[model samples]
Target chain A: MANIETSLKEAMTIDGAIGVALVDYTSGLTLGTLGGGTTMDMNIAAAGNTDVVRAKLRTLEMLGFSDGIEDILITLDSQYHLIRLLAGSQGLFLYLSLSKSRANLGLARHQLRKIEAELEI
Target chain B: MTSGSDPYQSVRDELAALRQQLTGVRGCVIAGVDGLLILHDSITGFEPHDVAALSAGAYGISRTTGSVLGQGAFSEVTIRSKDGYLAVYAVGELALLAVIGDSGSNIARLHLEARPVTQRLAEKLAIETSHPFG
Candidate 1:
């Protein structure tokens, strides 16, 4: 199993990855981050995603749904933002940004899931 | 306080109606952004004051999380457990509305029914805040 930094690094290795962050949603802080540049603002993006997760969670509860969210996807013109809440940690999540042109959505999601399962806090 | 003169009487009535409409609802508490209890019903077992304090506490971080992330405004938060659900919604600019429902209850229905009531309460709270002397 990979630790926090390793898990973040592993997430960066996926195809079309622009950046990845291990975030504590409760605090809106990133525990670890990798591969962000001038073109991509990791801080802003990662912090903003906590709300997306929050909204969906609220929606689920209001809808009376029993299932927990596996992943949330936001598609941009040039990018795909994927927010995955960890199965083990209730308020922690993995944020992965991908270049739509270079990444295969299916494969990237699969890899992220695999990494999430092996990730240790 | 006299019901005829009290602005909160309407809010209290709304809460009473909400309890009746939501099936298996455990209880509810409307709290201020600062964590003070404005109103409550049933919502037993849990301390009413604590529920208010915690709602404000959770809301602070949740609102910050929303603003910094560009998710617009923080609307509502829900924590579901084995027994049931605890849901909180932002009421206007001054308060929060929290509803507790059991496993057999439909949270969606509660939210649907409670939203209008929350809006009305928020309006009253807003009026009170704007005209404190009145």
Candidate 2:
């Protein structure tokens, strides 16, 4: 099983990986993080993303539907933000922020799935 | 609070379990639509109140997003950060589950696991509200 730290390191190796962190959406805290530099602030970014996760969950409830959320994708001019909720770990999720210039959305998604499968936590 | 027969109990229990399961997760909380705390299992620096407030904020954003898109309703929302990600899913009319994780977490799988529980809770709420005995 891949430990959280190793998983994070592997995630960084992805072509466009700028920074990575393991966050708890419920509390808006990062359990682990890697790669963000002067250009980005991982803490602030994690906190804000917490809001996005909460909003979508709220919307799902109000709609009176029972389906689950798969993943959330945000496309910016220079970045692709991907949020993948972890299965079996209720209230937990994975957040990936990639540089559009170097990341492949399709491949990133695929790789994330592979990592999730091997992740112990 | 309803009596022993309260149908909302199931929903509450489910949320509690979710909180427990995510014991290692930081900055995550399960809350009700009214911003009341249902469960808080944060492993980071945030307070329970802060998590609740963030959940409320997400609810507001979701409402606005629904309006703009002309969609009948909103389901889930996600925000990405340079170092982490936040995601929220609607469990039922009475509850919402929010998660904050690092960029390495698998959000997609989280959603899949949460969906069934949310659906079950919603049904229990519906039945309890619909029946006088409940």
Candidate 3:
């Protein structure tokens, strides 16, 4: 299994990736992060996005659906933010932000799924 | 101390269990982020209150550093002195777990053993007072 650092580093190699982080939605803590340079703050984004995850889960509970979220997509004017809930780890997720101009949405999603599969923590 | 019906017994039990799992553990304390002591299993000479307060200070600084540097939320902080180590772990959003270990202690192993305990302690200490009458 890929360790947290390696998983995060691998995530950064995805096309048009601006930043990535592995966050604990329960406490809004990032286990590891990469990219998100001067223009974007990966850490802040990681913590802030926990609310989004929580809200979605709450909605699922309210609806009494036994289903799981595949991923969340947020399209900004110039960026695409993706949040993928990792399996086998409760309250954990992988967050990726991509440059809209450079990213292929379908491929990014596929790459993230592959990375999540190998992630150990 | 009474075992059953004691609201804090589970906290006490967790501290004791941690000591059993890891060697060179001089002491352990659970404190609120505001610096109030929740419970502790410490040696005679150790000062838990002061340690709790200092731990709170350390947590505050470390969390701020993460935020300012855009690194993310504070996970834990470890300070190694020549004689021993002081490690502080965040317990959910409400409390901190501080461990004092001897010089021979393995830092990485301590982390592996202690992290899950913090999660359990958070669950035990969580006050379900949302509806006192319910």
Report the Cα interface RMSD of each model, rounded to 1 decimal: 11.6, 8.5, 12.0
How would the candidate models be sorted by lDDT, starting from the highest? 3, 1, 2
On residues A4-120, what C-alpha lDDT tens digit does candidate 1 reach at each position? 888888899899999998877654557888987788867666666765776788799999998999999889999999888899656888999999999999999999999999998
For the candidates in turn, chain A alone yields TM-scores of 0.96, 0.93, 0.97
Top TM-score prediction, candidate number = 3
Q: Candidate 1: DockQ? A: 0.02
Q: Give the alpha carbon lDDT tens digit for every residue of B1-134 in model 2.
A: 34676445656666556545442334556677667766655336667766666776787789688989898565677776776667776767666677776665445444544677668766765666567754
Task: Give the chain B TM-score for each candidate.
Answer: 0.87, 0.68, 0.90
CA lDDT of every candidate? 0.81, 0.71, 0.85
**lDDT winner among the candidates?**
3
Candidate 3, residues B20-110, lDDT tens digits: the string is 8766689998888998877789555878899899899999999999999999988899988888889999998879999998875645557
For all candidates, state DockQ relative to the true structure.
Answer: 0.02, 0.04, 0.02
Q: Which candidate's DockQ is highest? A: 2
Candidate 1 wrongly placed segments (more than 4 Å): A1-121, B1-6, B131-134
lDDT (C-alpha) at residue B121 in model 3: 75
Task: Report backbone clashes per prediction.
Answer: 3, 43, 0
